[model samples]
Structure formats: structure tokens, C-alpha cells
Target: MKVVETIKAVRNEVIAAKQTGFSIGFVPTMGYLHEGHVSLIEAARKDHDFVVLSIFVNPLQFGPNEDLDRYPRDFQRDEKIAQKAGVDVIFYPSVHEMYPTNMPMSIHVTSGVDVLCGSSRPGHFDGVATVVMKLLQIVQPNEAYFGQKDAQQLAIIMNMVEAFNVPVNIHGCPTVREEDGLAKSSRNVYLTNEDRAEAPFLYEALKEGANLILSGETRRSVILAELENRLGTGSGRIDYVDVLRYPSLEQSEQLSGKVILAVAYFYKNARLIDNYIVDIQEGEK
Candidate 1:
């Protein structure tokens, strides 16, 4: 597990790997490694000859009032976990290395950024697309791995790859969750003991939404109502509950094909999100 912090070093090593005909897999992350992150690493290790995990907490993705300053970090602990997950190289670059100067041009995100998380957080996906493009350019891997936990982000990245003709194959792995069904996140640590106890309801609500959709419910408003009702059992503040087409993330009146039941809620100071996707055939219940 070699760790390199400079842009030149990462690019040089990746170029060397390409010259040697080794297939590279990349996993880009904001630090505070958790089981969810490890799942992506493990997937990359399984499919590529070498796996590169970059743990740079991107400043661009964060809004002014967001948790950028307090966003968690423990590089020492993350290094151990990455090595254990069979990561070949850890690209731990500094902010200066990633952004030595202000970005000269903004990566305008046309699609997959006007809804869901993107709707509330303006310029968020632009930041995500820009940083992801930079990292993808630096690594120039044959394949890259991302978790389905950030479904919208995954969709945006996929869109960016297709639109820009980036050569890397993008893979969206399943969302890793706790035994009780809460989706694993680095921010899960912010939950109070009471908040943690109520947090699993986020997943439970999404599951119920999936079940309802699977049982032949097609109305969008009904499903949203049911999901909100299910999540309301907890003492948490509801952020948003939405259902949209998978990958495309467009809104639809009828639920069919692959659809995402996504929800975000605030429990104390912690904001938690969870979702369940259900694919319904043309005529099947």
C-alpha cells in the first residue's frame, strides 16, 4: 500500500502501470473511510489488476454553510482500512495539489443535477463532476468503482462519462448498509444515541416504498405520501422523499422499469439518507 500525495506522482505511477499493460481500477472518496467505502475498494480489487483509492476531501463539492470544516478526517485510520481492503495505491493529495489555483472554468452540469440532492444544494453536482473529472483524468484507469449509495451522484458521473467520451468504465456497486438496515455513511457518527436508534427508519421507509411499488402501485403522489408517512414515525425532521427513474433520475407519474425511492431526513444535527429501487415489468405485478 504505497501512499502518494502529489498530482505528478499519481499520474506518473498510473502512466507506468498503463505502459506495463496493467489494468487499473480507481475508487475516489472524501476521507472518513467506512464499510461503504471499503465495499467499493473490494469491488475494484476484484475486477482490476491494481486498485487505486484516493482519499481527498474535495472542497468544491461542499457549499459555504456545509460541513466542510467539520467534515471528518483520520488519514491514519483510513490508511489501515485501505491497506486491509487490498488497495495498491492510496492517492492522498493535499488541497493545494488538487486545486493549486481557482478553477479557471466551471464544469456546467446540464443533466442529473436539477433534482433530488442537487435541487437543494446548488452547484453541488458541478463540484462533484469537476472533481471526479480531475481524478479520473489523473488516474486514467480502465475502470472506476462507485457505490449506489449516492445514486444521483453515480448517475451524474455516468452521464459525464458518456457526454465527455471518457474511456473509463464506470461501475455502480450496491449500497453497503448496517445490519439494522441504515445505509452506512461517514456522517453516521454525528447521530446521537437516540438519533441512531431512530435512523434505521430511513431504510425501513424506503423498503416499504419498494414493497408498495412492487405490489402494483403506480401513482407517484401516493407512493411519496406513504413513504413520508412511514418515515414520520421517528422523531426526525423530514428533508425530502422522492421517487425518480434510476440512472436517468427523471420524474414520472407512473412507476415502471427501474425506479428509485429516495429519502433524506434530519435527526438532530445529522442528515441521513436511504433508498430502495424497484423494477416493475410492463404488465407484471
Candidate 2:
């Protein structure tokens, strides 16, 4: 696999690939590669003629008090994983290379930015949208792959693409989880042994909430309360547990259409999030 650190070089390569009629698939990540990230790359490899994986820890997407400085990263390890997953190019740009001097303006998907992780983190999704927009513009891939693990992020990116008329297909892959049921995340490395043991409860709680809704419960309050109660036993603090309409991500009061059951919490010093979607059955009023 070829690794290019400069935007000019990467863009030139992409341009050349496009001239050859290669459909590029892009996967933007912050390094610290794991099965979750690999899953995204693998999916992109299968669908596109050329795959580009970016490994820049976007400072804009991280809050001031967040784990930006300590966020896990190992480029050598990540490159190997990407190559094994059939990645054609790895864009390992530095912060300076991305931002440069006098980098003005940012992109924000206003609607979905005020809820869930967006509301909690403050400017998190704006950073996300901005960086993603930049990447989309720079890479100019035919399609981009994102994991459903960041359900809100996925929603916000799709919203930005639609609202801004960016011409790239956004594909959301299934959430990859650990053997113990904890959704895989780069932040999972921050968890203490005890915290790791308790982390799986987040998914368990989300599953229980979906089960409650599927078993004929329509009261949003009751479903959320039950999920909170279940997650309370974990060592971390529960940030939020919400059920919302699938792609739009508006809060849902009933299990109709594509509904998502999502949760976020803190384990040790790391913040984690997970979600699942359930299609309401027909004639289930």
C-alpha cells in the first residue's frame, strides 16, 4: 500500500486514479486501528476499485477537555492493518498540513448537531462536519464508509452531504463489537480493567431497551428509564440513552419506521457510545 502525507500528493494520486476510471472509496479515521476500523476498510475494499484511508487525529472534532492529546495512535501498526485490508492509499497528514495557516471557516450540519453526542460534546459535530467536508472535497471519492457505531456522526455527515449537495455516497456499516459485546472504539484503550468489565453493559442496556420496545412498549419515558436503570450498575456514568427515528435521528416516541436505540457513557476516562436499529413490525399498533 502507498502512504502519502501531503494533501497535494494525495490529491494528485486520486486525480490519476480517477483518470483511470477507478472508483475511490474513502475511510477517514484517527488511527489506533482496530477491528472496527478494519471492518470499514474491508467493506470499502469490496465495493470500490480504489480505497483511501486517512489517519489524521482531527483536533477540530475533539473538545478542549477531551482526549485529543492522549488519543491512541500508531501509524506503523495502522498502515499494516490498512494494507492487509486491501487499502490502496493511506493519507497520513499532519495537523499543520490539514489546517495550514489562516484556515478560516467551518462546516456545520445545524439540525443534527444539537442532539445526542453533539449536544453533550458542544461543537463536536461541527468539527466532525468540517473535517469530513474537507476530506470529501480533498479526496473526492465516489463513496465514503462510516461505521454505525457513531450513529449520530453518520447521520450528521449524510445530512451535510445532502444539504450541501456533495456528490459522494455515504455508506454506514454495522457496529463492530468485542467478543464480550462492548462496541469497539479507539477510546476503549483508556478503560481500566474494572471499567472494561462494566463497559459491555452499555450495549446490554441498549439491547434491553430495544427488546422492551419490540415487546409492545411504546412509552418513551418508560423505555429510557428502564435502560438507565440497567446501565446504572456500570462503573461509568450514563451520558444519554435515546431512541430516535433512523436516518433523520429525531427523538422517537414510538417504534415506528426505522428506529434507533442509542446510548453513550463514560468508562474510566473514556467516553463510549453504541446503538442499534429496529424496524417496527407491520400492523403492530
Candidate 3:
């Protein structure tokens, strides 16, 4: 219920909770709160004694032509949603609060920036990894929650934790969707009525592609082609349709084990993404 914009204030609350032997859960997000964001908060609250939700719209994670200036913000709405979801603290920091200095070293993402969303948006994941690291350090939570809708970003963060030996645990919660199958996102507001009607096909395409994988179709190129074909039936522009190993995110001609069938599509005004994660056994697929 408490909202604090200063680092000192947030640390004071978290430190006090730590001293009390209460486990901390942190959900870092930009301001707009949807069912997907609520799912992350609920997951954090389910197992942790205290939950801290940070709503800082990070500048580093945005591209020069991206919707940084126009990205949605509704503090009162977000506050109500977080509070209702059992959030204990809302770290509402400003850009200056998070980045006071002029310039400094950033965590340049070397490995996982070559594909998916990262492929088109250069330096995007670097910003994501940096801000996530910053938030993790600031909150010092026992566990942090993120949505699997951003499958590549989630994978990068999970890898960042292991590679850097960060103390906090990164949990990838399921992607919440609408009744019609569109993934929940802040940018969903940008869709026109026509685009909105056509949007659910992206998820359908991903689901169909996942079915191919589950039904003993192991060829990565075949799955990718089928996904693209399915998405091609829609009116939206196809950004990327790929199938890569989960967490590792490496491509394979013959996929084995857990892999994500993901797609990104551009509506007239909005870019939407959805994915299906499936595990393949050695002989089964």
C-alpha cells in the first residue's frame, strides 16, 4: 500500500522487512497494469512474505524511434491494481532517481541479442538486463517475477542471473491472455478495432505450431515455416516467427527438450507477440 519514489525509502522498507525475517518478492514493471502484470504480482505474493512492485518506465530499454514518450502511464490505476494484488510496496522512481549520472558502464548483452525482438532492436536487451540488474540490486528480493510472454527477455534475465551469480531467483510466470487468445500487454491499447479482431490469430498460429512440435515434428525450419504460414493468413505484418530452445535460446535443426515457438507481429499501430513453450522428449519427437 505504501508508495515511495526514493531509493532510500524503498530500501528502508525492504531492509526492515528483511530484519523481521520476511522473504521479499519484487515485480519490476512500467506503469500500465494488466492481467499479465497482476499474475506476476500474485505469483510473487503467493510464496513471499512481502512484495515490492517498481513502476519505473526505463529509458535505456527503449529505442530512439520507439514509444518512449508515448508509452502508457496511469499511476492511480497501477497503484490500485498492485494494492489489490497484495503488493506491499510500490517503488515509483523517476528517471533521475534511477539514472542520476551522465554516463556509466552498462551490461552489454553479448550472447542473447542476435534474434527475436533483440535482433531488430539493437541494444534493447542490454537496457533490459541493466535495468533488471539495477532493480534486483535495489530491492534485494529473495525472488523476482516476470512474464513468459517476453520469452527471450525472460531467458536473457534468467541467463544473466546465472552468469553474474546474482543472489535473487528469477521466476517466469505464465503469460496471461484474453478470452479470445490475445496476450495481455500495455501496447494492446494501440490496436484499432479491426486489428484487435485480427490479433488473436497470432496466438492461434503459435498454438498450431506448438501442436506440430508436440506431434513428432522436430524439424525447426518446418515448424518455423508453418508458423509463418499461419501468421501470414492474418493482415498484420510479420516481424519474426521463430522456434528456439527455451532459456538457452539457441536454434537447432532438430530440436530436443524445451523450446519456445514464438512470433512477433505488427498491427497498424501496435506490435504484439505471443509464444507457446513445449518440452520434447528424445524419442517422442
Candidate 4:
């Protein structure tokens, strides 16, 4: 339950914990802690001896016109939540601590950046990958936890860690949802009551799409069309509905291997994303 604000401070704590033979678990988040975040921290607590939670809202992750300033901030509130969730050290750093200067190089995956949330947000996943890379390096945990709700993000980090051969294990924990099946998110607070009612349909459509593929209806167009239509029933504008090879995030006419059914919907105050990943064997179910 220690909150330290510099990279050195976190490293000192992490090194001390490791010297005591405690395995570290890391959860990197932009503030506004929620049920989704708690799920990841709980997963880490279940497996690791020590947990480090970093709460810097990365400026690089926000787009130029994307309301970076107005995103949200309440360290006092988040600190209470993190301690309750069993975090051992909270790495709360400033933008300067993370960036220091314009980054000399950025981690960008060529394949996954062209679709889903990455397509609209441009350099968003690059920012995500970069920041996660920084945190993973800074914290140097035995395992790091991420929610599967950001399936594309999970995939990106998974790919990056593999390519770069980062030592930590990346765990894509299951997406936690509401009683009515909506994927829990920090952005859920912004949804108008009308948008909230319709938001659960995103998860429903994902479930339905997975069912369709499993039932021998494997055409990509049909699946995407069904999801777009289902969620776009005049509720919010449909950003994209995609079925892609998972982890790689590449598209193909015929689905195989790990596949993810993903969507992003634009409500009045929030743009929400959700997905369902299944290991698809086209003929054998």
C-alpha cells in the first residue's frame, strides 16, 4: 500500500521485493479505477506475491484533438481503490517521468495498427505499446495483467512482448461484465441512460457473432454485417465491426486459428469497445 511517484522509487521497491524472493505482478492503468481494473489486480494478487499498480494517465496515448486534458483524474480516489485491491506499490508518475523527452523511437506493429480502435485513433496503439513497454521495463514484474475487454490492446501487447522478447508473462484475463452483460469500463460512466441501455447490445452482438461462426456460418461479410446491424440499430454510430485472426489482428476471408469478434460503438459521451475471442476450427467447430 505504498504510493511512490518516480521511476526510481518504484524500481527501489521492486528490487527490494525481489531480493526477498517475492514475485511481482504489475497492472498498468490510466487512472479512473473501476471494476474492470479491480479484476486485473485481483487476478495478479491471486498469482503473485507482490503487486505493483502504475496510475499515470499517459499523454502520448491521447490523440491531439482527443480531449486529453478532460479525460479525468482523481488520485486520492484511485489510491484508495488500489490499496483495497491489494496492490503492494502504486507507481504514480508524472508525464515527464514517463516521457522525459520526445521518445527517440516508438514501438509500432505493422500488422495490427490498421484496424479496430487503432484505425480511427491513428497512433493510439503505438502510444499504448510504448507506455506499456515503459512500465514493463520500469516495474520488471514476473507477470503483468491486462483485461480482455481491450482485446486488440491485449493482442498488441502480447505480440510486442513476443517480438521483443520481454521477459514478463502477459496475462489476458477475461473481460468482467455487468449483470446485464455490458463489458465494464472506465468510460461506462459517460454513457447516457439511453446509451447505457443500448450498450449491452455490443456484448450481445459479439456473443451472437461467435455463435454464428461456430454454427458453420463462416463468411466474414455476413458476420460483420450482422454485428454492425445489430449494434447500429440507430443507437450509436458503428465505428467498426471486425472478425480477425487474434493476437495478429490480421483479416482474412476465411477464419482460422485464434479469432476475435470485435466492435467499437460511439455513444454521446463515450466510444465503447468490446470483443469475444474464440479458437476457431472452421470445419471441426
Q: Pick the candidate with the highest TM-score.
A: 3
Q: Give one digit per residue, the lDDT tens place, for model 4 in 11-35.
A: 9999999999999999999989989
Q: Count steric clashes of candidate 4.
A: 0
- Model 2 residue runs over 4 Å out of place are 282-285
How well does each candidate superpose onto the true structure, as a TM-score? Answer: 0.97, 0.95, 0.98, 0.96
Ranking by lDDT: 3, 1, 4, 2
Q: What is residue 101's positional error in candidate 4, in angstroms? A: 1.9
Error of 2 at 97 (Å): 1.2
TM-score head-to-head 1 vs 2, winner: 1
26: Cα error in model 3, Å: 0.4
Location of the lowest summed lDDT over 10 successive residues in candidate 2: 276-285
Worst 10 residues of 3 by lDDT: 276-285
- Model 2 error, position 6 (Å): 1.1
Model 1, residue pairs in steric clash: none
What's the CA error at residue 188 for candidate 4, in Å? 1.0
Best candidate, lDDT-wise? 3
- lDDT of candidate model 1 versus the reference: 0.89
Per-residue lDDT for 1-285 in model 1, tens only?
A: 899999889888888887888899999999789999999999999998889999998999999988899999999999999999999899999999999999999789988778888987899999999999999999999999998889898989999999999999999988999999889999999999989987888888888888888888988889999987887788988777899988789899987788898888888777887777778774211
Off by over 4 Å in 4: 282-285
lDDT of each: 0.89, 0.87, 0.91, 0.88
- Judge candidate 4 at residue 285 and give its lDDT: 22
Residue pairs clashing, model 3: none
